[model samples]
Target: MAQPNAQDDFAKLSADLSTLRSDVAKLTETLAAIAKSEGGAAADAITGRLRYGAARAEAAASGLAEEGYAALQDAKARAQALGGDLGATIERNPYGSVLAALGVGFLFGLLSRGR
Candidate 1:
């Protein structure tokens, strides 16, 4: 009787182990499927966001470039206007312009000597 009882217990333990293994395998399969599906979706979402960000950056750079070009054009126009004014002034008062230049040169010499 004792031997028969021990055999019965061993058989029950084997069945329990088999069931546990089957449950573990099913769980592993479910996890793998979930990871595969979710990983692809997450990757696609990240790629979309990156593309949007790149587009925004490109637009911002283009806008800044346009603004810089406009500013350069304005600066060139102003410099040309100032050059014309200076040329007219020099032509109108050559002697005064020469005297001013001599004075500026003297001042520069004095400042440079100190340096």
Candidate 2:
């Protein structure tokens, strides 16, 4: 067979290089597609966790609000009962109540004098 020509070898090399460039382009596109898919999945997982945390926090806040309201109602009832008792005592002994009030005021004044 005749020896291979330099022009023929050059043409073969150019064709091989073109095919390699096309393959590299295809590979880059495939890698980009895979990365996008993975990123989307990660985003979904993070969003799900955030929603779950928010729901838990809302429930805890609602529970705390209910407890605070119940405590306030209890305190109000006790205050009303004490007010009724004090009113009855004062009506039965008006002069004694006035004397006790003056004594308590004097003591309070003495205690707070330093402050």
Candidate 3:
């Protein structure tokens, strides 16, 4: 058999290099596609977690609001009952209440004068 020429060998080497470059380009495209898919999946998972956390937070805030409203209502009821009791007591002893008020004012005036 005749031996291959130098030009033939050079041409074969160039062809192999071109084939290698094409294969590398295809591999790069495939890897990029896979990474994009995985990134989307990861983002979806994070979004789900965030939504769950937000829902829990909202529920907790709603519970706290209910508790606060109950406490305020209880405080208002107590204050109203105390006011009625105070009014009855004042009506029953208007003269005594006036005397007590005058005494308190006199004491406060004396204290303000540093005497």
Candidate 4:
């Protein structure tokens, strides 16, 4: 379950990244068109501003991607650790684990009644 959720999260992240890349490409093309269609100092100034804005946006996107990658790594590590711990606990007390599972299921059933 954890693996499936992680995969889904990665899939969503990949889709979002692709969308961001496409948007950046479109913005770059638009800026280029504007710079080409106009002339003189005003056009130069606009191009400079657009370039600066694009650079900042690219940097921000890069930072966000790095952060997301780090978070995903952390989540994967935590999930692995949790799975190990749960396995150890169940191995140490199979009957306890079974009882706990049953209790949890019973509680869920009670809470979910008529839903």
TM per candidate: 0.84, 0.87, 0.81, 0.65
Return the TM-score for candidate 1, rounded to 2 decimals.
0.84
User: What CA RMSD would you report for each candidate?
Assistant: 2.4, 1.8, 2.8, 33.4
Candidate 3 Cα deviation (angstroms), residue 52: 0.5
Please count the clashing residue pairs in each candidate, in the order shown.
0, 0, 0, 0
Q: Model 3 over residues 1-115: C-alpha lDDT tens digits?
A: 9999999999999999999999999999999999999999999999999999999999999999999999999999999999999889899999998999999999989889953
Off by over 4 Å in 3: 1-4, 103-115
- Where does model 2 exceed 4 Å of error? none
> How would you encode candidate 1's per-residue C-alpha lDDT over 1-115 as one tens digit per residue?
3455888899999999999999999999999999999999999999999999999999999999999999999999999999999999999999999999999999999988953
lDDT of 4 by residue, 1-115 (tens): 3446888889999999999999999999999888777656677889999999999999999999999999999999999999999999999999999999999999999999995
Our tally of clashes for model 3 stands at 0
Best by TM-score: 2
What's the lDDT for all of these models? 0.97, 0.99, 0.97, 0.95
Candidate 3 worst ten-residue window by lDDT: 106-115
Candidate 2 structure quality by residue, lDDT tens digits, 14-114: 99999999999999999999999999999999999999999999999999999999999999999999999999999999999999999999999999998
